[model samples]
Target: MTTETTPKPQHPPLEPATEGQVLSGAEILVQSLMRAGVDVAFGYPGGAIMDTFHFLNRSPIEFILSRHEQGATHMADGYARVTGKAGVVIVTSGPGATNTITGIATANMDSVPLVVITGQVPTTMVGNDAFQEADVVGITRPISKHNYLINDVRDVARVVREAFHIATTGRPGPVVIDFPKDVQQAQTAFHWPESVDIRGYRPDRLEKKISPSHPMVQKAAKAIMRAKRPVLYVGGGAVIAGASEEVTALARRCQIPVTTTLTGLGAFPEDDPLSLQMLGMHGTEYANYAVDQCDTIIAVGARFDDRVTGKIAEFMPQCECVIHIDIDPSSISKNIQVDIPITGDAKACLAALLELVEPTERSEWAEQVLAWKKHHPLREEFGDDEIHPQRVISAIDEIAGPDKITVTDVGQHQMWACHFITHLRPRSWLSSGGLGTMGYGLPAAIGAKVAAPDRAVWCISGDGGIQMNMQEMTTAALNEIAVKVAVLNNQYLGMVRQWQQLFYGRNYSYTCLRRRSICEKVCRDPGSGKCQAYLPNIVAMAEACGWQAQRVERRAGIRDAIQWAEETPGPVLLEFSVHREDNVWPMIPAGQGVKKMMRGMELI
Candidate 1:
């Protein structure tokens, strides 16, 4: 069959009318967003931002009115993570702006692209601490990739364009634009820049080709060829750069095993034999062992974060050579020294390495990794009686399918989801990876569903974490976003309690969400009859919000619960009554080395 596939035609970037009637700064701002191709934005309205909101009401851009600013930011983050586009957010001054800090930090940590616009007080009241005023640029300086406080109404179009450009470019992260109230009211001619030229802001520098003959690429290839055991450790950068195919090609071609960070989930298919689901704290035991044993480590788009490198000295002690590849030059050897540092896009560097490196059989190394995998497989069985959190996640994975997008809030459930769900596609797994923000799941799922309305979205949250932004349930219900929320109700702050149990001799200290003050510090088992009743019935709350809801306590009912949520007409909340005191295993205690991993009552 000799059939030619036509290439998809590319459309030119949308441009605003050059001689269009003069418009208010708010109108120009909306037009700027339209020009940048922003179809949806998550935000809240307040005095400073009222003008923009008024204009937004008439615009085609879909505005999602999140219950909280933090939730709105996460929604934008989730959208960006799934669509690879800069998610947009707009909020008013002071408290509204500060509320988004957590979300901004979360997005920054994960390298998710977001353009956050905050309405500011008038320029005259800049330092006067006017009503609802804030120094948003100052507050977000450290967290955002870049931030701006608009001084002139004419700068609106240019600033908006730059914000989007900065957000989506190399080493993507959130960019903040503070639009003053007076500027929004001021009149200006809207002239969207055809191209932005920011001096010293040359993200394009990272787009350069790394030829196969480049010395660094050649050196990386040689290092790979020389090592008998090489491990490909990837991170979120791989997902952001769309370098999954290149990463997999390099791993398979070189016969190297692959392990990814939590943010890097789905960068390489987890079902593959060479795939070591995740590495570092709460990572697979086999994966950690492989990293410890490998002679060569090729770190792609992964900065050696503290979570990933428990104790740097003890991490990869056997590794004699390191090849680091990332778009950000500073990220290379920032944490761990690298023998070969290639500063360029992940895909480009991997492609270059693929060309120079000759494929060789490393059967012995592969066998050793497989042996480790066999010896210490992930604990998936918790008997058939009670429902385990892992089983809940597994059931969801089965029902939702690999193609579905899964979002998670921070806690035991998040780790369990990472451990169990086999994410087959990049960006399908969304979580507050860097910041570990609680209450991010529901809103993020809303954003993900909004971004890809056709794809099924599942949100996995824990009892405590879900409560942080549970109010967003109304937002989801009102929008008719069919996001299936699985609350793993363990009746305790699982992660904190686990730490307390392991380190503080089970003091339990305030970790019990259900405990009353009169209860003992070391409370009785939640399953025991002595324990108090679980409060604020989650199922009842969901139903109150006009959502289809269910509560499941038995393992036999997991599938049916998940299926019900999937088939429900609108947003559904499934509360899985998980076992209390259950902990995420294969955990490296904080400040300890990866080698000192605790797995189900045994330290490896």
Candidate 2:
């Protein structure tokens, strides 16, 4: 018997394609961004972008209000680094956009992908020096990977979409999109396109991007196989390329030891048995010794920066072959003569090398390296002084453990922090390596904490450097970010002072900055008992910023105070009053070779 036919329950098609309602130009821009998957933005609101900000709030997008425009940009940078996405930063015209230039330049140098939007003055006000007007597009042209000034409201949607694409593609640098205030307010039909078309922005079609299948990979693999004592030198690019695990595996497979640049700390866990820590200027004795003794040096994703190679001619003299792999072709053979140059993503290239190289035990070479390590262990000479920077750094490392992240400003204390702290994870230690910016520690720590709230973040700064960005403590307090700051109060720009003592016959020009009293006021000439450059009491400053504060006058109190601050669930500051005359040595003076290092203390 045939079953009775049942009526099917049918639903209407979701809907056939139809023309959507026309929207304001601002609405189109917002819709375009939503299509590009921008979930969050960081910026300071101002009048020029008022219209855009108003519409932006109506969308699902979230905005993190930053204390300053510069801080907003850096926060975006930190977010980008952590998420592997193009960070979005928006600001208003004139001073607002200009304040972000430093951060833009920094991202460019580091090859971070960022989408920076600035609000332009009304189209009619262009070139008329209108109120709050500045040529942001013209100013940022040299630094950004690409930029566009959108005068017409109709082009806002297209320009923003293309900006995101350009920023994230190719070498991955920052891109700027300037939207006129009038454009943000203007209404037009909103149609979010499924794809973007940009002539100069195709990254995948490029022929120069190195892949594992390149012909040079075989030559590089051959060198590694033939060499007896190979050392793996890595840098920040390795961290950015996510090649740490592969690098460690390659080192183990080839029985090679590893050392890293300052920015490369954590790329290879410093605590790893095969890791030699860092090399060059402030590098460990074992690390430097390994470089001095290795026969084959394989540099992966690291620029042979002068700071690492120290007078390139005499650097790694025993190394006969140097195999270099970098994403940027310009970095290859720029400093040291490279025997085999394989330009590519570090992770991909390293994986290919592992496939090509046959695992072999280099017993004799390992023995020799272990012998050198044993002979040249890192020394900590914490003499019977009132305060020792080394002891403080070591205590911090012990208290915070390997899971914590440390950010430092440039100075003698920076060198000490590098020498003492042991990094156990990739990108765990962030500092201004290339720029060597003095006030980086506090702001950078704030940025890192904002990016990774769960990780313990600490700012290692000199008294001089900390003071430079003391204003950032307010930023931390405002955000309720519990970043701890350890100030090495040496009462001088200690690095410059050390240089003068070693190279300039201790002329001691402007380096001597003396405190007036326990109040921490700067004294122009304490020799005469009169004070001029009074310093703000950092502990009190922290307290004013609604943070826990402590001043450790004695050396013994430093470690405990640091431990307390790290354990405290809020922003804390520990100021250790160290000797003003202490120096960071093993210094390679201007144009000096590794052999020409100035030791911390004169040999008997």
Candidate 3:
């Protein structure tokens, strides 16, 4: 019956009103954000939210105007993923609020903290279907960690404080604050609370109670000691909790071979000897094998996702003990049952476990993982005549180095980037892991660039995904935020086409991007020479948006193109014509186990 939330921010809340000072709700909201330490926000303006936007003009908080409402939310998501503080977004009601659904869902799924301020119709027009009014609270309730509707302008300061607190704490996710147009215009005696007090929620108890001597920590430590082959499965929670140091300490203390989920990439450095890299579907062969053969699994801040776990019955067939430590109490055993379930903040729990456990060696386990890694190394064994997708990604990874930020869209390219790129720090690798949204890369990259302008930011997206937020290039260009984008153009929707080719006997239906009405009826073959025409030139699109653009088709052009983009300033795009049918290797088919992993075309 216990529930725990994310750790509250260390930043102290603003002092309560020394004396009553009247202010509009719009100004109150902006002041609340400034006190919450929000330096930047992203949004598009509209009628319902225009008053707040006007107040924002005078506030010190930096705002980036996005082309689309959806893109604005996604940009906030991207900004939140990398930064310590919750990202802020402001948009008008109805379609503006609804447009943010996908991005909200994306943040919800991944546990990214974001405060989205949505405008609503006049209070008197509630349920009357006034212009640009929609039930935002009702629509977003399911996706957001929490949501609120300001009934009175007097509650603006309190609601904004609560929204940021709830969004950043206890399984961090987006929070929607629906402010009516009337409320924005109304006057209030602005007063910020000294502290947030939610009656039913008490994560402080969990934080204060969990120590090295806690029963669950002791139990997990015992479990770790007994197992001859232990594996540390790290995930995004570690990143959110800033527990990478703790995670690394525990892994090295036990010398347990570490494997990360896609979102868990940077928790343990891939270059480390104990690291098995990413596991599950589209994971490294060694990491999956390590999970399958290990006797113990100590999952840290990671849920047993279907993407990571495959078939529930068949996953971890040899594992004898399961130790799960997460900040969210509900997530502990939701997917897979665990013997030792420690629920608290990841940094706290991992630190406690680190103190309880002693150093140990598992040479046999290490050798087994090494053998698996060498047997099927992460690479592309394809002909050099064509520009393979892996080549473009790997070239970029090498050029970008280990410290730069790398964001990816979903599909084969996402999996390829996961396999090829090396992320040495938490929050360095960003992707829509849970939602698998296609258009996430570009806007998210802009957000990251805004958060960390000094660092190099790269968006490795598919041709299809880039187009979804391609218009954001104008936002990046006008702002002069330099974000390098590489489009892996495989002609067809690579992942879907790979599936159709694999399970459906090559009956490629509607996956092709270049399929014209004339080619749709007769063209069934993948990589058909007859269909030479490609639409919506990616380079031209980038150029039109005031970005430095290039097109690379040959193998040699991969490095040069990526290098050029890196060297160039402002926003840049590199479109690579990759092999159309090259599928991501080491893929675990849906509803299957690691035994059924497809490296080339067949299950291993």
| Residue 136, candidate 3: C-alpha displacement in angstroms | 0.4
State TM-scores per candidate: 0.95, 0.88, 0.96
Q: Report the Cα lDDT for candidate 1.
A: 0.90
Model 3: runs farther than 4 Å from truth? 1-19, 602-604
> Each model's C-alpha lDDT?
0.90, 0.79, 0.88
Number of backbone collisions per candidate, in order?
A: 0, 12, 3
Give the residue spans of candidate 2 off by over 4 A: 1-21, 25-35, 56-62, 205-213, 515-534
Identify the superior model by lDDT, candidate 2 or candidate 3.
3
Tell me the lDDT of model 2 at 321: 93
| lDDT tens digits by residue: candidate 2, 315-408 | 8989999899877778888988898887677788888878788887999878877886787666776558587787888989998887888888
Ranking by TM-score: 3, 1, 2
Evaluate model 2: give its TM-score. 0.88
